[model samples]
Target: MTSLVKVLNENTIYNSEKLSNFIKYLEEKYIIKDEVIFFNQLVNFSQNNSIPLHGWFKYREGYSHTLVREMITRFTIDTKKEFIVDPFCGAGTTLVEAAVNNLDSMGVDVNPMSVAVTNAKTNSYSKADIEEVKLLIEEIPSIDLDQTEIIDYEDIQQYFSEDNFRALLAIKEFVNNISKPSVKELFFSGFLSIIEDSSDRKRDGNGLKKSLSKVTSVIDFYCDKMKLLMADISESSFCNIGKGYFGSATQLDKYVHEFSEEINKKPGLIVFSPPYANSFDYFESYKMELRMGDFIPRLGVKGLSDLRRLAIRSFVSAAKDPIEVDEIIDLMAIEIEEAIPLKETYTGKKDSRTRKVPQMIRGYFHDMGKVLEKCGKVLESGHKCCIVVDQSSYLGKIVPTDLFLAYLGEQVGFNVKEIIICRKAKTSGQQLQKYPYLAESLRESIVVLEKK
Candidate 1:
């Protein structure tokens, strides 16, 4: 049986058997350890709902605070460096956890909503800010906005009932007039959190879809969300602990350098989950929220397209951009490219998206390699970098994302300590019909690396 390493090095076509053998080979070579019980609910977002500040927003993409706490506990043992860094700070879970532990941290993301969420959850909330939020809630009923100014984003309008849509606009107007920056952020955060719930459509898979969910009144929902935010703020000891920047992880060094200069400390541990190689575009998933919050409007008219280009090239839709990177994993890219069938291969129906997988895979790794290189530069010596990522399957071809990232980490001055297989993941139902063999092979893993 051809090994994955040999196939990758030879730049040969990877068949299902070769791919299967390669996974087994990697498992043995890396000393794979299954620790599913250890990570049970820690890797999920459902556990976050009852946890003070974490529960303020329902971010389905984020990992739990317990998971971050576990990483800090394991890595922060004897390390002299005292700061945490989350390059892909989705929902600010890592930053919040760092702050909860009284450690200074910084986070960066391409999405403005992500930065906004991180800033809201991690920023210091003063007593006056809390008072201002209370006043806004009291004035919620009397506040009504003139509809002439608000740009009619039809996409967002379709997701809500007429009354609910009007309520959303009213709150957006109300949030804009708030004087205090911190208070404004807090209210804005609360408003964004309720967007999915208020809309008739829910964020499912790659984008929003019509759902059975209903909100009696958008205003009531926002009020309830604010109350939750207020309670978390009143009880939490968050004091400007983490800085969230609206930027990319490939520029990890720049973000870290700015923060390091102020605090005189490099990141003790780097914990992040980049977008998976799966063709899931986060911009599409949060389109309503992004438009409603005016995060995209800052990018001009072609806001969504521009933002997608800025994000890591993990999705197929982003494959249209020119592929450019410092290091190209030529062999693996070749194999992935070959495995994706040509347009002629489809017998019945053809997915045009399938043709772009090869380029997306190449771009994803090249983009990730740059991020790893920057991670290697910014992370403290001998400190660990923990990555949460899921492997993907296209047709019958399995993309071992965890292993590839580990390989990339090694190339960029890091030692792979171990790969903890969190759980065996199944491929999409559609893919499973065509590729049953991939079901048992794919997994979600934590790639732990120490900067050498």
Candidate 2:
């Protein structure tokens, strides 16, 4: 067997030749399949279902389930371990797969809403729970559309007719009355999934935000979204699972430590698609959901600024150290420097926010490192971890996220085994002129690491 130490060094960018050789060796030894075939299978499965975990969250900028599954398969093969950990688990794709495979798994994210969605999707529950929630929703008094005036809310009002909004609010009110955390979370998952579609924001055919309208009503939008959410939840297997929690990954160690010996031995697997190195602000993109769910106060004139502060603080709190902040800032600075030349090459004016990419990148990695460190401590030795990440470009400079994270994983005591380059679909509205190098390729790489 190749030594863990050797594998760790092989993941570095400087060791590209050795890394390629090692990956080929693993493919032959472990019967690893081709990337193209693997991607095709996932796409087909998603098309058949029309509701991939990727599609369910409708995070236009998120990672695909095909990529997530590939990472899980690769890690399980290499370590021959069933348990997994995704410290930055979002929307519970990893947790749901883990549950389906009957692997004990653990997932964590700083976003409370993400935790709610993931938890709702992964927990085991009874058919009775769904029936009961359904009955409860039916019993709630019908919402009077004329009285509610849901369109008055600023964030998401224009997407739905008044009747749909009232129906959605009624469901929310009914779910609120139910004291069961598992039931409430399951319902909430459905509620959140519909937010974008019910809003005034123009959606691409796949239900992602294109542009937000000023006249949008947040309340009405949330109401309509809740109805769609309810329908989606009713269709999923998650209605039968256990409840997940709302907490930061940085606090996972403490939470896990409190579990009794018997529970601790259950061993957990985590699969997640964390924020990318590029400057996609998940907090802002998803702020409407939070606002509608009452997770955060309204985003008024001061809303964006207030939310930004909250986001930065939340991320920083989840990080392992003060220095991580600086490291992420440095990485973002590198991205900014690269993007500047691209600005001249591309016709449109660059978003001023592009300049702040460095700070966001810094904060993202810093928190991710801390979460990984915590995961290392909580996961049992010999367990496997699979992170699906992409290499990003800012300006024209490439951010070798897979290699950089592999290095960070080693520093936190995990052993980097392989980095698999898989070709996947490109992001929406991604102009080839804007990303000349990416025109012929949509490369999504998976970094497989094992807990020592």
Candidate 3:
């Protein structure tokens, strides 16, 4: 009759009795009020098998797999449905978990890189297929090209070595040659994951800095990175399990509408973590992938046109009302105004470009609103949609994301049921804020809405 925690700590095989004791222990220690029994079962299962989507791409800011499992458990108890949808499915965490639970699920993301990663993780693939791809990847011959002509401006060459870059380029060429869409996607994902590692960019460093600036030889950097990536893939060949799509959430409505006629039922749950109001450029962070994929027109240049087009599309389709649109505009304007002084302080003239924050925010919400409207339509009545979001404070003003989402949900004919606060680690800048309240306040909240 050893304690469950002790047994778990000792790495002993858990039986029914030991698992029950663990559930009781969790309830006593953490005050888990709902689905304790289910959670125990899930934890036991997780011990045996790697969590599906959680293993895909390792993002420093990625959501916890444990948290996702808990959310899924809660979702199952609240509704009796078979399908879940994550409109902003970063790395396909939700979809992978849903599939593991034996529920059909759909995930959508605007970032092509994220979509590629998601698709690779969720899609069912045989070990033979993976081995074949691995063999093909190894067969690629490394060829060195003159660094000056091939590498673009703003290219983070430090992230990869010359030899590694040639190896990576060879692999990229082979992946592009693959005929099957599914296999191509898997290869591309693995390629994308290694890009940062292969480059001179310090992959292990904090993301806030331009760590890639220090590296000089891109080819050798990429080669080293890919070799490591290939090793990881070779070791963990069994866990990948989800599919991904390259499209905007705003555009997904049309896709769903077309498919809806074939199916009478709506999704049981729709969960997502959309981009925050903080104005971090997702495109900028993964510019390397866009460069490799040839999605961006030119290397090292920010695609302002692409950004503007996406914003316009999202705004046009997602805005529920004039007020929501206005709110987005106002937020964007503030961000634009704030950027002026920041540009003035920086030595780079390029930093002085007009801040697109205003446009980006407006476009984000407008698209999100449209996505919510579509979700309201596709979600079955009484089913739940949970969004993990955070209020972002910029220039000493707080963006009330939770409040805004609640309002948007009401406009789309859903009732905001609850807002569960989840504490977040404060950034250093936030910690230095003069106002103690601002420094210590909750940043994230799970907004739960029900389609009526």
Candidate 4:
């Protein structure tokens, strides 16, 4: 059998035709359609800018609350099941929406900050709970810096002005003194929410970079956030039946089973946007929050590595090695492996990041395969699992992520319902400059699957 590399060398036409044929096969078999009208505005976090609890913290990778509500209504119309689950509930958009509609929900994420944020948003707050945080905010101005026990973590000091840093420490000290568990979690989340804005560095592409503006008022930001949170809670019309767990999505079956037993209802619908295999690490993006909030106890490279190992291997840093997959996916991974090195030869530079793309692709699918299998088990039969994912491009060769996951779902006891194309995805600027044709291949889609 000829390798894809050899085929690319001897006959470029054959290689292109093979990929095109596979893509066409997947599309025809899956019943895909362009449904941008339904999902164009609902596929991202931009729509949550004004939606009360969701707007308190910005998570660029999360989908909209409107999307979850739409899916819950559309998928559960014929059923009596009133429960929801999000395995990769980044900031808990699905869980929050579920609670607002008086539905029971469960969310799980590997990132502690994500769990913290989700818990704060989904927990029911009594009028006294609201008043407790209000008092904490009132007392923020009078706290003394000298009495605060501030343990400065590594590399955290440079991001803030000295006075702002001390002010933040004072607030953390006050919030820590709050004895009630729920109120403590809520205020701690509020503290974490203001860290990015209070710092001189802002979250950029893969990590943090220095912002143009310097030295934001940490106390001011905290007060405003608390006010907004209080108002949202006061106007909340229903009790919170949502809970977040600090754990990996790969172990979702365990949590889902326990939740089902406790609530006496299996989840009717599952909706989430998993981490994209675009080499972007959430740990790198949330370093400030993790460190300052004491969410991650480990201190150096070893600690960071431990956390990455627990997460789904979607980026080069987290992906350790390649694993065997089905023939359809194996072919796509091999093409990526063959294409990346040729790109290096053309530019006369060995880019380590570009070279690791193949490994990331293999590991990403392997982890997601486990997650989808669990979703099939815990969800009530005949319900829908909606995943919002975007395709990735490497040197103009597109990785059809939606198709790959759809195929994986079939192997794990799910019937592919439809692939809704949300919108065209823009490839990285560097990849587009090198391969102008990539624009036609990249897109974001919602892969809808129903349990068999």
Q: What C-alpha lDDT do the candidate models reach, one value each?
A: 0.79, 0.55, 0.57, 0.79
Give per-residue CA lDDT, model 3, range 1-452, as digits (tens). Answer: 12223433443222234333433343244321223344446445553124434654555445655556677887773223345677777777776666666555667776766777777766665666666666655554344243223345235444456665655666666677888776677667767866665565543322323344433554444444445445544454434233445666677665454434334334667788777665555665566666676667654345534643453232222223334474434544454556557545764555322344445456566767887888888777888888777765444333456656766787898887776555432434642463234444425666788999
Q: lDDT at 402 for candidate 1?
A: 92
Off by over 4 Å in 2: 1-34, 47-63, 70-74, 77-83, 137-167, 203-243, 258-262, 266-269, 301-332, 338-351, 424-431, 440-442
Error of 3 at 332 (Å): 11
Residue pairs in candidate 1 whose N, alpha carbon or C atoms collide under 3 angstroms: none
Writing each residue's lDDT as its tens digit, candidate 4 over 293-333 gives: 87766446765676788898888876655587777666776
What lDDT, from 0 to 1, does candidate 4 have?
A: 0.79
Cα deviation of 179, candidate 3, in Å: 4.0
Model 4, which residues run further than 4 Å from truth? 1-19, 41-46, 77-80, 212-216
1-452: candidate 1 lDDT, tens digit per residue: 22334434443326445454555566566745677766875656448778988887777778768877888888773234568899999889899988888888999998889789889988887788788878888887666645624466765667778777788888988898998898899999999988888888988888778984488877778888888888888888675469899888989999999998887776788998788998888888788888899877632348788888789998887766667642334444555566555524755556677778878888898899999999999876888999988888776666788988887888899998998877766578877776555555577788999999
Better of 1 and 2 by TM-score: 1
lDDT over C-alpha atoms for residue 85 of model 4: 87
